[model samples]
Target: MIKRKKIYIEALRILAIFLVLFQHVPAFDYYLQDTSHVMGHLFFTLIAKINVPLFLMISGSLLLNREEGYREIFRKRMIKIILAILIFNFLVYLAENQFVFDLQDYCLGVFENGIDRSYWYLYSYLGFLVMMPLLHRIAQKMTKNDFILILFIHFVFSTIEPLLQWFVPTYLGQSFEFTWAFRIPFSTIKEIFYPLMGYYIDRKIHIESIHKKTLAGLGCLSLLGILISMFFTIWIGNQEGFSDEYLELFDYVSALSAFILIKSFFVHYEAVIPAWISQKIVLLGSVTYGVYLWDPFFRKLFFDGFDQFMIPWVGGFFSSVLWCICSFLVCGILVQFLKRIPKVKSLF
Candidate 1:
């Protein structure tokens, strides 16, 4: 296993995240909503898609070798996520000033109701947290033959999941009625297999011999995946033309595949960029979670009346980026403060 902390890997994580962030920029819809040309930022979806699964894959590779038992693993993983959910949801309630009725409604359907909006990611990730230990053990057991079987298990589950939800109908994701984030019980259980395959692949595949060539191959696959997904997204948008609700599901899957390919490229690459720019990117990327959470508020703060501001596109764009950075910094400070709070220290 690659034991040392690779700064480039960390950089890839942050970069993938920002692709998600920039893709969320409202200006893309503003510019490309009805045009022949797609916004550059729209490609962010293709790039950003890999962000989460890559994260999980990385987690699997890094954590599977740990010596901790199941109970210790569970405590280590779940406590912080569960606490984060509780604290963040409680804060959301306070901001909204209404009772969550013991999180009954929020748990039942946050996406559908749009009650506590940001908690969807929290719920889905928490679901992952709960299942990690079992997944790790499974990874340790599989032989060469078992690899294909494990992958088959993942493929079958992924294929049937969406169909079953629409036709047979069951509780697909977290208990939240609003959005499953598509991580249902079966899929969540099935999720155990992918990380192992990722871990398996990483361990068996030596990039040192053909780092440059493999990186090229991964880059091509990543490109192919993104182009196909972008076509699907753009096609649906133009013809079937956007089911804001359902299309996002396609987008998410596409993003995941692309992310994995990109991750492989970085992992296999020997030549990294300059330390100064890499460091800056990593720093910005470090604040990405906070940035994702707070970007909307920052947009509201700075860009609410951007067009009316007497300045040109340069001013407006800078304002948007600047406000995003400011928001990340502010949230970073808040996260730091939260870490200091005795009761809340564990949540981070």
Candidate 2:
């Protein structure tokens, strides 16, 4: 028998999808470039950075505690993700082509990176799935303190060290490197860190705040992340011209805080939320996988023109927000229509 669904997981999934779409709403252009739009682009990109890690966290929260055997997990979960990559990548390829085939370009895209670069998450997530059993086993052996230490280590090596290396040379007139024995694995734990922490926080930590303090605190943390991102963008992005693509420590901390806050809120108040609203949230959440698959197509088809018109009228920020909302509505409807077919719907 299937286990009952968790409300917060669904809510978080919906939030993640919206943020993902928000990041994709074509905002930056030479014609639209201004201080406000540049600021908007920065804010949009910063918040949207949470989407992938949050998605992984959702998976960990729901699945890490499962009793299924590795074989079952591999067959049921890993295989499905692999199939999604193949199926969705094919659709992306077809959508990009106007009946003309470029075999060399197509092969390079599919083999080198992916059909659509955004689909790289699917591939990385496939690797995550393959490692889930090991991660689960490791997590089971870890205590709260141990996990906290892991997070600390991960932050220092993955985020702080990298940031220092990137910015220190400019400020200090020299590059700094750790002694050979003192060096840590820089980015090795990135994909696994948030997910493992998500499982730990969801299962082990029992949090409740009836006064909505958790949500308030998360809002504050998110704001702090924004400030940190702004500082870096103005300081480093200005100097470097925005080439580096590292997701910083503040982003992950803010994302984790928000993730925990939402989980706490839904856990404590799931019953108090109106059934209709809850059903709607869950319904949208159910189609997020499909939305992620089809959103780019709809964005190009519907929002491209809307963006050009709206960005000039309003600004990049609000235009993108409007585009994001339209994307959800259109993609939701599109997914619903596709779901009418039994076999085709399963691919999404």
lDDT of 2: 0.72
Error of 2 at 242 (Å): 4.3
Alpha-carbon RMSD, candidate 2:
3.5
Model 2 worst lDDT run, 10 consecutive residues = 27-36
Error of 1 at 319 (Å): 7.5
Model 1 C-alpha lDDT versus the unseen true structure:
0.52
What are the lDDT scores of the predictions, listed in order? 0.52, 0.72
Strongest candidate by lDDT: 2
lDDT of 1 by residue, 290-343 (tens): 554544444444445653452365543344444444555676666556657897
